[model samples]
Target: MTLLYEPERFKDESRTKRSKRQLLLTKAEEIFRTQGIASTSMIDIAKIAGVERRTLYNYYNNKEEMAIDIQIEYLRNYGATVEFKINHDLDYTKQLESYCDTYIKRFLNNKNYIIFITQFDYHFRHFSMDDNLDRYHKIMKDRNMTNNPAMEIIALICKQKELNVDDQLIRKFFFTLHHCILGVAQRVIFRESVFIEEQDYSSEDIQILIPILVNGIVSTLPSYQK
Candidate 1:
């Protein structure tokens, strides 16, 4: 006779697996924050997690795989918060200002997570990117569009303001300004001087620039009076 399928038993097993995975991630994040992912090892994670090396291997073949999972989860949660804050009905300038404000506010509030992200970006360069495409694919899949959310928002702003900027130019503009902002924030959190003693920048300086930069970009649009 064929055996009966035990759905409840399978569900319990799934929950156990998820719980163990979460425990491992929690321990790994703490260790990665202090030692950096490049300096971290699977053995370190397993030891910190209080589990056998084989247990970690069951969830992830290696540290990079585990780190990728943590990174994706972090991005997904942060993206949800951002999507919730965006007022789609707002005008172009207000919308962009809101987006910038949200980014700065979140970064300030979650300094440790931002630090992890900064370190993760550096560590990610040495690893193969084949398994790292989950976040990108999810973003594309969710939006069902060619451009990323930022690019789409920028394009919308241009259309609303009747700006003559090319789509490629907008893409370039966003990436350039974004990296500048992120780099400044990262340095501030890292407690490094931002090059000007006495008038040296803080996260507050980054905050002040957000509106100025938003307005600066908006004012440059053909429709906005410069």
Candidate 2:
């Protein structure tokens, strides 16, 4: 029995679909980054993508759907980078700092993406965003993407520091840290001078406070001796 190769026509069609989808997302992200998501429409995206309205619809039902997919794509890249940065050789504090550094570097490297996220948070709300996020998480789970990078990093910390605490306790701590870092990064990108001009503190200095806070928390952890 011989295995039959897929026909060239089918291969070409698949490639064309992928190419068009990529073009659609590229154009859509550009519009989203410049014009707020609420201001941008399917027609605008289609026009920028150089595709018919119906063709754009063939890929996504609405801008919300495309936005969710684009977010998932960015997060997947971030997750991969986080996974790569996890070093078992480092001690607990260093590992935690590495995680924070990853976020700071990635956010500073792509201010546009950080700006887009700020816009997205301001514009999207209620049921539609919730439903889309649920769908996005499902896709991530199906693809075996890391569901919680912070959880993974914290677990490593527990191992390296010889800390024995309840899983729930560590989870709560790490999640809080995760959001705290994220919120700080977004603020840094959106209002670079707010900290300095108004608060008399440099944004960089404010960011440094997070690692110091993290170190303080780790020091106080019941199992952490140093």
Candidate 3:
């Protein structure tokens, strides 16, 4: 007797596969955070994920691929959050402030992930940024977009204020702010706060730096006036 195909069964199977994949990813993330990525193996991941070694391999070709997938997922989430914060009816300065503060807070919250990704790349002799940027470019290319989240937000603010600037200038401005934020985050993470004298920098101190950095960058624009 011939059996009829059940679409619901197929849907359920797909959902199960996705659920298992996410579970493995989550377990791998935890192991990477605690034991460090360099020390984590496929067996360790499978044991932590409570899956067979073959099952983990079925979802990912190898551990590096799995780690990259996790990083991409994180970046996508980060981009979405930035887009949500910036895509609002508020004025440009307010939007910029929100963007800056959100970025700082997010990085501070995920400092471990940030450090893990960085160390993973160093251990593997890979540049995770290169991989991340390649994926970012592909997505942007598919969407017929050029600027990243940071660049797009900065451009929006400039356009709203009628600040005339070329793409190159806008890019420079974006990188300037980007590096500033990263520098501040690095300092805080490493317990080497630049401006604050305390060994432990408070969130309030970081909040104060956001507006100062934003205003410093804004003040450099040709259209900006004292």
Q: What is the TM-score of each candidate against the true structure?
A: 0.71, 0.73, 0.68
What is the clash count of model 3? Answer: 0
Off by over 4 Å in 2: 1-13, 84-90, 126-131, 139-163, 193-206, 223-226
Q: Candidate 1 residues 67-106, lDDT tens each?
A: 6666666665443234424456877667776677777787
Q: Rank the candidates by TM-score, best first.
A: 2, 1, 3
Report the C-alpha displacement of residue 21, candidate 3, in angstroms.
Answer: 0.7
Provide the lowest-lDDT 10-residue window in model 1: 1-10
Error of 2 at 14 (Å): 0.9
Task: Identify the superior model by lDDT, candidate 2 or candidate 3.
Answer: 2
Evaluation by TM-score, superior candidate among 1 and 2: 2
Which lDDT tens digits does candidate 2 get at residues 11-51? 65576676677678878888887788889989999998888
Candidate 3 wrong stretches, greater than 4 Å: 1-13, 80-91, 109-112, 124-163, 190-198, 202-204, 223-226
lDDT of 3 by residue, 161-211 (tens): 777778777777777787677665555664434435655555446678778
How many angstroms is residue 200 displaced in model 3 relative to the true structure, after the best TM-score fit? 2.3
lDDT, residue 30, candidate 2 = 84
